[model samples]
Target: MIKNEKIKATEVQLTGLNGEDLGIMSTRDALALAKQHKVDLICMSLMTSPPPCKLMGAGAAKQEKQQEKKKAAKTPDKRKVKEIRLNLQMEDHDRETKQSQAERILTKGDSVKLVIQVHGAKEGTAGKEWAEQLCKSLAEYGSKTTGIQVSGKQVVVQLDPIE
Candidate 1:
């Protein structure tokens, strides 16, 4: 926004500090009016034939911008991914513990990557069944985002939190 002496328009549509329209007048007159009110002559728009300007305290505008920045800084991104590893040989208690951890992360608005690693032969046929069962167990907290995929010795699937 052009302010005070920086404004080049010879005439402008002015508004007072109290928001009352002062109508169209010379830029010099508007500057003098702002000086009398101890405020800034800020050009609001340049689209009209004679640009529009308003009277406002510069310190107030600066404070508002600082407040907006602080408000933006307070919120953190929630799209982070948490990884949990499982295996076909996991015991009941171990599986339950991993499921609880995944549930905790999902409830906090983070996604989870489930990885079941198979060490021996028949990687595709052996690992997918266990992965499906695990996925069903976690259905209440999150939905599966990807189909069970088998690559070499690893079976991977992604789950996104329910919003």
Candidate 2:
């Protein structure tokens, strides 16, 4: 998390709230001065050789920071991944429907996971090829993050984030 408020220091060469130079003093003395004027002691810069700070409204400053965080979180970034499943013998119509759903999810800035199940005898002969074909078709909808992998009787592939 990042802080957005410019804090005021207690003492030192008091750069006024608006950046005016007010000379030096102790943190306690500066805080007292700000208190007399009804303000907060904000530490703006503490990394200098002697450390520098500022003064502001603690509550208002915190609220403004929270608002900025909320705004940033609301801005969509295309890095989240969503998952979908398919069976080895899934009908063409069903596969198409699932692909449509995947497209919707990807359009909203999400990656997709295509999971295929290979059951019993279906796991033999051309099961692996079938899985590969399913992965290929899905890749047409979105970039491939991970190629198909067979684990026991299931195949899994991850889709890259949609552009």
Candidate 3:
């Protein structure tokens, strides 16, 4: 914000200390008025034809900026959830690769949802066991947030990164 002696515009749209419009006036007169009130003549915006300037205390402006910074710092960023699907009859090598992928995701502070699906008539009984074992193997990287859920031919569980 351009202030006082630095304001190049001969005339400015001035706003008073109490937010009242003082109309378009010479910058010298506005500076004098600001001096009279022991405040600052800060250019609020430079985009207009006759830039709008306000009379504000320098300390007040700094305090407002600090308050905004504090508000921003208080808000937390949201984490993303990654989904990985597994087959009930996955081979040992493939299972190990999937486990490593899940660990990588968890290390990055993201949640992982594991979905295990079984096909055919006789594979339903072992799906839950397979899912539970996979979850247990990944326990070091993340903790289970949801219990194993069995619905039809699928078993699902969610793991959240360890803080």
Best by TM-score: 1
Backbone clashes under 3 angstroms, per model: 0, 10, 0
What TM-score number comes out for model 1? 0.64
Candidate 3: residue pairs that collide:
none
All candidates' TM-scores? 0.64, 0.62, 0.55
Regions of candidate 2 where Cα sits further than 4 Å from its true position = 1-16, 19-26, 43-52, 77-80, 120-128
- Per-residue lDDT for 1-163 in model 1, tens only? 5789999999999988788999999999999999998999998778987998888999866775688889999988669988888887889899899989999999999999999888756766678887788789889989999999888888999999999
Which has the better lDDT: candidate 1, or candidate 2? 1
Whole-model Cα lDDT per candidate? 0.88, 0.66, 0.87
* Stretch of 10 with least lDDT, candidate 2: 1-10
For candidate 3, give the lDDT of residue 100.
93
lDDT of 3 by residue, 53-98 (tens): 8899999867867998899999977778899999977898998999
lDDT by residue (104-148, candidate 2, tens digit) is: 776666788877778764473355676566556656567777766
Give the TM-score (vs. native) of candidate 3: 0.55
- The candidate with the higher TM-score, 1 or 2, is 1
Model 1 has an lDDT value of 0.88
